[model samples]
Target: MRLLSTIMLALFLVFSMSGAVLAQEAQTNTTDPIIVGNQDAESLQVVQSYFETMDSNLLAEDVSYFDEQSIQAIEGRDMLTQSPTFMYGDSFTEQQLTPLRYIVTEDVVVVEYTFVGRNTGSYATLPATNQLVSVPTVGIYHVEDGQITGIREYMDSDDLYTQLGYPAYTGVQPVAPFTLPEPNAVDDIVDNPPAFYGQEVTIEGGFGEMVGPNAFTLWDEDFIDIGQEGLLVLAASDGAFDFTPVEETMLRVTGTVYEYDRASLEGTVGYALDEGTFTDYQNFTVLVASEIANMDNVDTLANVDQQPESFYGQTVTLEGHIGDTVGDSAFVLFRDQLVGVGGRVLVIAPDFDPATVENNQVQVTGVVQPVDAPTIVTETGLTLDENLLSDYQDWTALIANEVMSVE
Candidate 1:
């Protein structure tokens, strides 16, 4: 009986070992090159092909691959009730995808691709310009039961701007030629001013002081103003562009003109010149200012900040306050003006006695010239006038023109 039991035990051990080996072999087979018969591998291929087809459809502006029951969730809220629909026809075109590393784990798939676009139409109210932009985007796709259920995309708007030749200015104006039409040619310029009373003309000027939050004061050597009221302001030449952080100087702007009423006066206010008017032109140039102020002040500061090279030896009025008194001899002044979004304060300093300026509400009058570098740091963190500081002894001193009493 003992011998029979031993033989039975040995047979049992061999069968158990055989089962363990088979299990190991099965695990190894699952990791080998995916076979066409494998359901999971087939599902992965289908998902990848779907993405490729969807990319092609997006380029063609055809919204079909979306599931009939699919919904679009933007920023956590469902934006669509049924399948994704395109309200506007072909808003995005010229889509190219550069495949980056992709990872598929369990039920989640992540794809990284560089999306390059050109001549793309605007998605919503953003105008469709011929600007070429490239953005690196990552998409997270959640898959369940062999079907992709959700997708999310991530990218940065500032990165998109940088790809389109729009770099944030550092508050330093560059040297550029300024060409204004002859006074006699004013009749040929576009002169459709806003309904509000104000003159519309394209003028070339250097950047001036910044006033309120996003507004800057513009000035030209030849341009003159009557009073500080009545103006309709907008940013950009076509009145479509707007920006933030008003302390960054150096821009070229063109817009309409309107009168500013008492109720509209918020920041530092300027008036429109009645004599100058553009008959056939609708744009103007704003070469330099602390920052592009707000759209409301664009009409007032437009054409006031001309190109720096145009005002090489001209005295200009700049507003701001004493920021940093470099020494007893010199201190930097901060001025505000409107340019892009609202307005910002610019820093202006010269080689002079800083003792004269008591507070931050002092104005400075100085010659507008090109500085190889910036000498002043605006309150908004942009540096200006760094180059020509050696010529002036106290790089921080500024000539105060007017001092406003702030309570």
Candidate 2:
């Protein structure tokens, strides 16, 4: 009887120890146990789906959890997103949302979460500062029939701007005037010329063959077929109207669109069109210009020389031949055809390998800055020649973003 009692006690101890180990293992392996609080299960599940959609970077168009009427109503109020709430995935990357608290009633479910992501896109007209933001946000959602009926999100906008390296918002800020008109396609204008009559507009397309000294045929940028419809442009009498007649170059013309009246247009531009030369444009739509300029942003090195101040401190894409190297990280970019006009500009690229661009046509996208030797040396750590530095002072220099061979 003594031996049996001792055996029975040992069995009980073993069983108790085994039961505790099994309980711990089960707890450790449990998957997302429902966080229970003053919350209704049905409403909490609906709210959980809403956040899951955000975590997956799925927009309203891509998901069906949101009510159609709620989305429409929210979009009507939010002009920037055109949605009920801010979509983090639209402007941010690697979004991580942590729900801190959930306050649920019979119909309303409010969730407080922390939002974190890297800002890689422009928002509210502010440039991308590439900063990371971790902001606390609250979203009040109205649920019915396991669907969201309405949503109201609250967050500190000023805090968002501050995190993005911008000044804190006051009541008002200055907005640049939008003076330039939106550009119209040449084909669109040509096909429906009457629709654009008398409207002051801008058209961008190829420098499609020149019709006269002050006149040219403008067609779609890629139009190649013969007899393609073109818009006739009668340039302004102002000397500002000058362009290389290369078909590869694009040009922007801003003027009033009108039915081509040969005699009237001749009187307006102070130049008569040749009868045979402009016969194709008779009674057709034409643009009587106030301005005509290159549409491309600094396509050639020579353009930078002509307007150095305009490009100074601005980023530009320059195409030219890589001239002699200045140092391990610096070289000169110039166009062979533009040598006479001093098309050469100094370029400094720390990450670029010069061998790739040797004797090759290259395109360099970089910021255009004035050649100040002290600043260049300080910023780029390049040891440029003293004589070369003095000679190129106040001239334009490009701190390259990339140097690619254009074969």
Candidate 3:
């Protein structure tokens, strides 16, 4: 069972044997089927169960498919159960596998399938690339007497990592999470993030630093310093409590994950939206904490200045001399009132009727979320069209969850 996993990443037929694929190509009901004997039919069933267990991430602790006398040449049954072949679900939000071919002989069953999913989570030791991949793999199972005796699997690892947007593994395993996901890890939100959209979950991870009045970055234990792409969290709890930064061991219950729509406004005032895109989605797993506590000894959270680009996804407070307005709801705050080249933070409050913030001094509190950054798109197959910050427009800002205390 352990040795039989790689079949999902193996065979990738450039084209089907014919222009038309045989949908009902079953050998059982028809005169031409792959079944040989009763054992052959059962072996096929066993192989199917193996893939099902893998997809569900419920690898049996005691591998019943292989006994002590099993000749698992490539690896042992226990190793296979915990092996990378079975760990695909750990990093991917969705791994949809569909069988392509099944070549069954007397005692051996070889199967082919295509594995398609977005790489949103990390491998054992590697970080997530947040890319999508679709590839074919081959799996072989050897049945002797009754139980599976041997197994062989092949996955196209040469460019699989590159395709999935991750560096090849170098014998490193991903760091274990402090607390199990109410289903997934913190970094798991990167790829196929929309899968967890609108779902209420409790996630745990390290406290990277504080971003704003009540916003902070929750770092994945494996890649602590990776960046602001995945670890931004906002507290939905009462403002009475202040969150202190600590190690990767805090818990959040109201974590709501969402993605930003970059091209929402282009021709609007001071708005230059990037139209071209690369990745299908760029997500941030946010948490409005119902409850939070620091398990570490550190009491200080790293403070970032009014650097909106640097503080993307962080909740920061800015006291600036107000400047101008864009539309009915959005206004500008010129922190650098003299030079004005340092750029400005756009404050949009549509809920606040009859928008009334003047060019006076005021305190702004909100998340410094990125509006337009670099994005990846495909011109053709391998041809990539990258959208950089300078390519369109750039001005990360404090999206005011609440703007108050005008002075």
Q: What is the TM-score of each candidate against the true structure?
A: 0.26, 0.33, 0.29
lDDT string for model 1 (218-284, tens) is 4432122211111223332222235542332333334333333322322223333222232211233
lDDT of each: 0.37, 0.63, 0.47
Model 3 misplacement above 4 A: 1-40, 53-76, 84-89, 166-407
**Residue 340 displacement in candidate 3 (angstroms):** 72
Predicted structure 1, TM vs. truth? 0.26
Candidate 1: 10-residue stretch with minimal lDDT: 63-72
Q: How many Å off is the CA of 37 in candidate 3?
A: 9.8
**Could you give candidate 3's per-residue lDDT for residues 44-114 as a string of tens digits?**
76666665664322322323232111222224457665555353636776777766666555555666666
Which residue pairs overlap in candidate 2's backbone?
none
Best by lDDT: 2
Residue 28 lDDT in candidate 3:
40
lDDT of predicted model 3:
0.47
Clashes of each: 71, 0, 24
Best by TM-score: 2
